[model samples]
Target: MKILVGIDTGVNTGFAVAVDEGKGGDLIQVISLTITQAMARVIELCELYSKSQVYLYIEDPRKRTWFTGGREKAQGVGSVKRDAQIWENWCKENKIKYTLVHPKDNCTKYKSDTFKKVTGWMGRTNEHARDAAMLVHRRSVRA
Candidate 1:
């Protein structure tokens, strides 16, 4: 089994988990969670999927430049960057393999309908989840 976890870190972080079994198609789960909850969920998933080959991919907010944005936007960017760092440190501590993907590496903003059509996934999802899922879009193996 191969488990891929994608995270879009911020106040309302997006967390997505896709599990692939050689015999069957991928099973994907997407949810919007608080930053703290995202961390806890990641840890829990690591424990539950201990036997699987798990990889984490986080959207790196540091890659973008925030210029002249309002205070709120600036704060949000700072918080997201901070959360990404936390994720990186946790992965390093646990010896988990992880990758930091640039925000613009792919099309992160996808409407729900478009996301469903693209991934061939009928599950419900929010913008954050869509962004996170797009990070591992290549690995999604649908039936």
Candidate 2:
């Protein structure tokens, strides 16, 4: 079994997890919540799926968010970076093979836009979870 995780952050953070069950990847879970909860959930997932290969796909943390006719907002970028760093360290310590995939690499568009499209009405809410599932599906096909 293999798993892919996707994350998108804005007004709210969205997380999606996908699991590969031989044939392909399927959406196993979806969540949109505060950064703290997101991190906690990631940890939980890691433990739950300890036997599976876990890959995390997150939007580039370095990208700046420029508002229309206004200055850029760096509000959540720091938190994203911090969360990523924590996850990275955890993976290393636990010997979990993980990969950080840029959103543009998968969607061929801006991370925000790609996230919006993938999430639809749900918007940023729980979108990451859906995105994670999609990433897993794609990975499974490629594998």
Candidate 3:
């Protein structure tokens, strides 16, 4: 068995999981939740899929940027780096293998563009979740 996990982190983080059950790529599950909730979900997934070899595809946080009051925001308001660090620590503690994937590797030239396309398709709600799921789909097909 093989399992792939994709994650999009920010103010609204999203996570998607795909499984290869000897039948090619199949979307096993998807979720849009808070960063804290997403972390919990990841832990749950690790346990649920422990029997299989898992590979994580996480959107690199360094590429994300945000603005506030007409100027770039430096802290708070969902820091991708912070989120990534948390996830990284969790992965280390749990012995989960993870890979950092840039948004361009998946699609969407820019972070904002990625967010727009994802949110636009998902109706501006749960965009991160939808994007995360789409990333999984994209990678699975490519594989």
lDDT of 2: 0.57
* Global fold similarity of model 2 (TM-score): 0.60
**Candidate 2 residues 5-61, lDDT tens each?**
666644465566776667655665666677667667777777887635666666555
RMSD of each: 3.5, 5.0, 5.1
Model 2 residue 79 CA deviation (Å) reads 4.5
Model-by-model lDDT, in order?
0.79, 0.57, 0.66
**lDDT: worst 10-residue window of model 2:** 64-73
Candidate 1 lDDT over 116-142, as tens digits, reads 888877888899988888776656433
lDDT of 1 at 19: 70
Candidate 3 structure lDDT: 0.66
lDDT of 1 at 3: 79
